[model samples]
Target: MPILSKETKAAILGAIHLKTESVDVPEWGDGVTILVSEMSGLARDAFYAKKEGGKVPISQSQADLLLATVVDETGALVLDESDVASLQAQGTAVLDRVVAVAVRLNGMQPAAVEDAVKNSAAAPSGDSGSSSASTSASQ
Candidate 1:
């Protein structure tokens, strides 16, 4: 389901308490591994920290490290948008090259196929004229 929408943005922000002008740390102890909650909070905090100029613009390696750490330590999923965009760009490049080759190959198809089909359907005597002419020519 789509959770992010203009209408739900404010509610989401409110639910996460981003606009509450304060940070509240959830209680952590007693072997309670709130993995999802902690990782999600960390991700959210990282983003908001950048937005608030509390952190620098994350580099590619830094982003990778962050994603790896979150996924490894907390078993959380994370994606770097710019990394995804780069991968998509590379995929499109490959597709475009494939299409170019396909177009060229397709362009060579028509005449050879036409001739092959026509020749294959020809009579054993190779006569395509009138019936009388064909009979005389065959004999």
Candidate 2:
């Protein structure tokens, strides 16, 4: 294969390459459906960042993923940050089903999400004393 020029590489990187699928949700209502799309690299990175230091709650992580991947027919996001609480309030069965699709489309394993939740739950909330103790011990 010929080596791609800088312009060609730029064009390839700038193109829309994510995939979208329609997810059926009988639980929501008869004939209810939603458009789920693969998260872009940047979006995926940001999603993971939310889990960093275990600051984000498990429900918020799920809501964040939903907001990032659930889009409309025009490929625009259907939900925004303002809708996070509403999304979290949704039935867990339907929400998990949709989130599973988003996770698969984004090439993330279910274990990753489970692990994030576990880590977050185990993390100390606003407890800096542990760190200070470790620092003093080392010194």
Candidate 3:
């Protein structure tokens, strides 16, 4: 409902590069196998490699673990709260940019996007209002 188009998702995924790869960890070893991308360590493959069927987002636990815990150079799980916060912030920022860019790329004006967000956030309770709003927005 919050304007989650494929282009938006794809932009975020492409920017995030959510994939399993090795990272450099000087403290433990040379490299560690973990779920990470070029940008941040947010595991999200389903969204990147989505097919025609449906979209499967990353689970909350997975994200928490990936961001909060990183495999050390010695293949040890290390919990770093600061790292978690940083990764979360980076992911959020990327998503925000992707949404903004995607909306513009989809031919939605700034005002229209604002209206769409408002409509989606607090849509009328009744079915009639919802239907009418949807019809109007589509036009």
Against the true structure, whose TM-score is highest?
Answer: 2
- Better candidate number, 1 or 2, judged by TM-score: 2
Q: Considering summed lDDT, which 10 consecutive residues are worst modelled in model 1?
A: 17-26
- Each prediction's total of clashing residue pairs, residues at least 3 apart in sequence or on different chains, is 0, 0, 1
TM-score, prediction 1: 0.18
Ranking of all predicted structures according to lDDT, beginning with the best and ending with the worst: 2, 3, 1
lDDT of 1 by residue, 1-139 (tens): 3255698778766653211111121322344321111234465446445546355433432343333222223244434555534423333343333333322332324676577568768746745566442233211
Clashing residue pairs, backbone N/CA/C < 3 A, model 3: 29-73
Q: Candidate 2 residues 1-139, lDDT tens each?
A: 2234685777666668779989999977899999999988788888788778957766788899998999998888899999999988888888889988998887688787688778879988885565332333211
Give lDDT: candidate 2, residue 51: 74
Q: Model 1: residues >4 Å from true position, as ranges? A: 1-39, 54-69, 73-139
Q: Which candidate is the best by lDDT?
A: 2
The residue pairs that clash in candidate 2, if any, are: none
How many backbone collisions does model 3 have? 1
Q: Local error of candidate 3 at 93, Å?
A: 10
In candidate 1 the C-alpha lDDT for residue 73 amounts to 38
- Candidate 3 segments whose C-alpha is farther than 4 A from its true place: 1-62, 67-69, 92-139
Ranking by TM-score: 2, 3, 1
